[model samples]
Target chain A: MKIAFYIFSSLVFVALQTTIFRELTFIGVAPQICLVLVVVAGMLSGKEWGAICGAGMGLLYDIVSGRIVGLNAILFMYIGFFVGVLCKGFFKHKRIVVLFFTAAAELTYSILYYFFAFFIWGQMNIIYVFSKIIVPELLYTTVVAVPIYVLMEKINDYIERKTF
Target chain B: MRYIFEHKIAVLIISLTIVFLVFMASYTSDKARANLGKDGLSTMVLPFQIVFTSVTHNVQDFFAHFGDLEAAGKRIEELETQVAVLENNSRELEDTKLENERLSSLVGIKDSLKSNDSIAAQIIAKDVSNWYTVFTINKGSGDGIADKQAVITTKGLVGYVSEVGAKWAKVTTIINDGTAVGGLVVRTQDVAIVEGEFELQKDLLCKMTYISKGANIVTGDSIETSGLGGIYPKGILIGIIRDVKPETQTVSQNAIIEPAVNFEKVSEVLVLK
Candidate 1:
């Protein structure tokens, strides 16, 4: 049942990212709400579920994007699994930790993406890319990540309560 | 081996990672490697995207009316001035049309774009990642749209169709880093390659490279498709030169172009067949 819900939500998130959020740009960057969802899944469940959820969401995004497939799936799977494992201790359930991890994951994702997508293609303007693309998207994603995290927490809690 | 057996989650993660990496390698090597997954996923998501896009448009239009009231007087004055200029231009255009018909009859040149058919498609969704400037349209192979077809707005060239599915096609806009178009400066007739640069894409601009040092191109010089590239048809307006960067040691002189079609606001496009 949980897996089914994750699959359904993944579809909605992919749709939203490509449509509504695509139109709503902050500093010419959109908030990566899908990444936030992956983080939330890891925090709520465990490493296994987190990685599974991330892989699912990333595959959907890759298919929709029509780019090289499976790149996002692998990156997001690691991010989800590590976040779940690292936050297992005292950091678990803390909103501040979610913000920190979300920012870190976004930074890592942006850098790796730039390296693969642009840098390898001989666009080595890291400073310009960092200032213009990476930083703005990071800040925007970080700010929006909190609210999405909170919302996901509420939903997970509701699901737990209903299941029990 | 015992540890791997005990740690089922770890095994799963490692296995999935390997599978994904392998899949990525294969897909990269063969772009035409059956797109069944992509086609299936796109078909499922297309309806939702259409709904969301329409809702967003409606909301924007609703708010635009409020803003329109404040700008009404200014717009009317602007329109009045435009009407006067258009009337003058229309008279000149009529004479030019007569002259063009005579010249074309003498030369026996046929306009290819006018003879070809085109299909109108609405943008259903944009690229999920900020790194690429691609968009999905509602019409695809099912509607007679095919790969490498030129997409254009009434204003000017938007880009070309990069990938096509049954009912959807992805457009790689001229601002995307992967796109290159053959451009000709209308005034100087100097031909060059217009490419989408990473830095300029953020500002919705492209650059015309391979320009000779002696090229007489200037700011506001109009660019059109040279028809040298097999993809985009000839004589379609690409953009106007915003600025020119002088040649450096390793790089040739290039001019920054502001595309005629505002990518952000373009909702519908015609796919030239």
Candidate 2:
């Protein structure tokens, strides 16, 4: 039941990421909601659930929206695991931690993505990508992370109580 | 061995990442088969995506209509005058001689162009990695949509369908770097080549190259598809030249074009089947 619930919820995130979120662009760039979902899932759960949920979400997104089959799958999985480890050491309730975690996840995803997707093709424009796309995305994702974290926390509570 | 066994989940995740990357690399090298998975998944998610796309569009339209209402009144008055003039012109067309020549010319032109068969579709999805601005539309193979078909809005050419599924298809827009279309100056009848670039897209422009030294093209000259490629019909409006850089010894002459179709606001498009 927990597995099914996570899968269902993650698909909703993927659906919204592509459809609704694309329309509500913040200065021509939209927040990567699936990235946020993976991070928030890690924060709310442990590394185990985080990795599982991230892989599922990433694979779904890759198949639906990505050019590469498993690119986002691995990228998001690492983010989920890393978030779980970092938040475990820090005060997860703190706003600064949330900002830092979301920012770090976005940064890591963008770097790995640029390298994997563009660097291989000799299209990596580091200055332009970092300044124009990555930094603005990081800021937007960080701001949006607050509400997402709250939603994840509630979802986590429901999952935990149901399982127990 | 015991240490590795003690942390099974971490080991599993690490292994999974490595495996997925290896497989992804293989798939990238041979992307022809990659569409199998994508087509299946897209078909599965079509209904939900359609619902979300429609719901959001309705909500957006609800808000956009409030702004359009005030302007619509003035537009209606202007259109009313246009109707009167058109009605008078239709009455003038009752003269048989002028009408026959116009009809014959239109029929001759239409015979040369394959522009009649078209299907309308609504955009359902778009993502950020879209240096190509890849998007999915609701109609698909079931609706006779196919790959490499031209997509256009009422204003002008929009893009081409790249992938098709059972109930959905993905479109690669004109702003993507990979797209190349044969175009030329409509006024001077000088042919040129147009291509997409991520850099120029920031300014909402595209690059048009291969202009001859004496082409006499200038800023504000209209560019239209030359129909040499057979992918799109001839004479479809592409854009107007925004900036002209004269030919250098090393580089061909080129111009930056501001596309006639406002890509950002494109909601509905017609796919030439």
Candidate 3:
């Protein structure tokens, strides 16, 4: 029952992140609450469950977007696996550290996305993505990180205490 | 690492399962694209898009109402200036009406064009990505809006019906990529093709192509439909030419035009033959 609640809350966060948080784009900075949640899931649920959650989120992202047919799937899955491994040691406490990690994860994802989209897709407009999408998005997402971490932490605590 | 190696079998199986699912889904999507022209994929996706758009619009409306009211004030001031100009023109026309009647009688021409076919429609949804200004209007085949029917604003051309639902229709604006208009320059009597680029800000502008370099095209020339294309009727206003340039060292020229209709604020439209 606790596991079900965690999963459902994560989904709600992801939906809001794409729909509502999406409006908070500041130039290149955009809130990536989904990335933070995926990383947190990997940390808490270990490798197998982390991968499952990553795959589910990736599929949902694909459905909402009109572009990138299977690109999100591969990126999110790999991010989940690595983040899961990275979080094994810090699975409990340390909210500040978790917030830092979330920002780092988002930056890493954005940089990688720029490379794949520019180099692989042969769209040499890296400046447009960096200026219009990436930079401003970074500031917005970083600021949003603190609140998201608090929400995730509260949800985690509520589930563990079985206080539903 | 040791545990991962031991559980390697599960990882391999899961990876294979995902690969297979992706392959199958890709294959199905290819088939879906081929059948898309016949099947109504937009209809299936329309409801979700509408709900999401409405939610976003509500949020934007909350923030933008003040700005809109300010703009309305400025518009009222401009309209008053126009009204003063029209009042002067009406007084001048009052004395010239008999002279105009004598000229028309000599030419043996009708006072105005015939026909009163029109249907009104309200805008339902717009793409928020601002990529395609294609909108759904609350009138379709049932409401006398047929496929490819020309949509117009009080000013001029809006777009044409691209797709139809039971009670709604998707009107693809002239600003959508590759949309071409057979338009005639009002003053020069020269004909040219107007085309759309993917860029939305440029919707207020369209590319007027294939004009002969020798044609005396210039900025501020009014462009209208030439009635060459069966899609739109003759004499419907499109835009005023903002600039004209030679397309190449070749035989054609391209002109930037300011569209008559403000796509961003369209609420209602009329469809006509």
Instruction: Give the top-scoring candidate (lDDT).
Output: 1
| Root-mean-square deviation of Cα positions for candidate 2 versus the true structure, in angstroms | 3.0
For residues B1-273, write the lDDT of model 3, one tens digit per residue.
887689874675368457735743664322212123222433444455446546766888888998799899999999999999999999999869878878978998654223548889876555322223566676766676677778889998888877665566767788765588899999989999988854423335678888988899889999998878878878889989888777667788888888998876676899874
Clashing pairs in 1: none
- Estimate, for each residue in B1-273, the C-alpha lDDT of model 1 and write its tens digit: 899989988899899889888878877623522277789887888888899999999999999999999799999999999999999999999999889979987999877677879999999999898887888999988899888899999999999988889899999999998689999999999999999988889789999999888888899999999999799999999999999988777446889999999999999999999
**Which of the numbered candidates is closest to the native, going by highest DockQ?**
1
Considering DockQ, where higher is better, how would the candidates rank from best to worst?
1, 2, 3
Query: Candidate 1 at B259: error in angstroms?
Result: 0.8
All candidates: TM-score: 0.94, 0.90, 0.60
| Candidate 3: regions farther than 4 A off | A1-50, A91-122, B1-212, B215-273
DockQ, prediction 2 = 0.60
Taking chain A by itself, what TM-score does each prediction score?
A: 0.95, 0.92, 0.79
lDDT accuracy of residue A30 in candidate 3: 41
lDDT of 2 by residue, A1-34 (tens): 7687778778777778778877777766778888
TM-score for the B chain of model 3: 0.70
DockQ of 3: 0.17
* lDDT (tens digit, per residue) of candidate 2 on B1-273: 997899988798988888888868767532422266677766666677778888998899899999999999999999999999998888887776467768878777553245468999988877534234778888888898877888988888888877777778778777776688889789999988888876766455789988888788888999988988878888888989999998678346888888988877888899987
lDDT by candidate, in order shown: 0.88, 0.79, 0.66
Report the lDDT of model 1 for residue B247.
77
